[model samples]
Target: MIVATGDYHVLTDILVILERWTICHRRYHHCATSLRLKCTEL
Candidate 1:
């Protein structure tokens, strides 16, 4: 993979953004599922 310094920084920024989104998405899904289960049980 040919990566210049500018491209590297851009890629790093994208990766960081993606990682943040993934963490938030997982947390949201987990909370939503848990709430659904609790509500169903109640």
Candidate 2:
């Protein structure tokens, strides 16, 4: 039971990290696209 609990905690931590990374990546991608569009317009 103790081992299972430890594994669960590790999984939760990994999930949190992945979620943050995905959000940052999405925001960066969006900003890059917007910048590209503006450059093209110029």
Candidate 3:
């Protein structure tokens, strides 16, 4: 039972990391695109 609980905690942590990574990646892409557009305009 303890092992199972530990595994669950690990899985939850991994999920949180993945979620944050995806969100950061999306924001980075958005910022990059806007910067590219600005550079093109200049």
lDDT of 2 at 36: 43
Q: lDDT of all predictions, in order shown?
A: 0.67, 0.65, 0.65
Better of 1 and 3 by TM-score: 3
RMSD of 3: 9.4
**How far does residue 1 in candidate 1 sit from its true spot (Å)?**
7.0
Candidate topping TM-score: 3
RMSD of 1: 9.6
Off by over 4 Å in 1: 30-42
Q: In angstroms, how far off is 2's CA in candidate 2?
A: 9.9
User: For each candidate, what TM-score against the reference?
Assistant: 0.57, 0.55, 0.58
Q: lDDT for model 1, on a 0 to 1 scale?
A: 0.67
Global CA lDDT computed for model 2: 0.65
lDDT of 1 by residue, 1-42 (tens): 888999999999889877766666655655777654544342
CA lDDT of 13 in candidate 1?
85
Instruction: Name the runs in model 2 displaced over 4 angstroms.
Output: 1-3, 30-42
TM-score of model number 2: 0.55
For every candidate, C-alpha RMSD to the true structure in Å: 9.6, 9.6, 9.4
Which 10-residue window of candidate 2 scores lowest in summed lDDT? 33-42
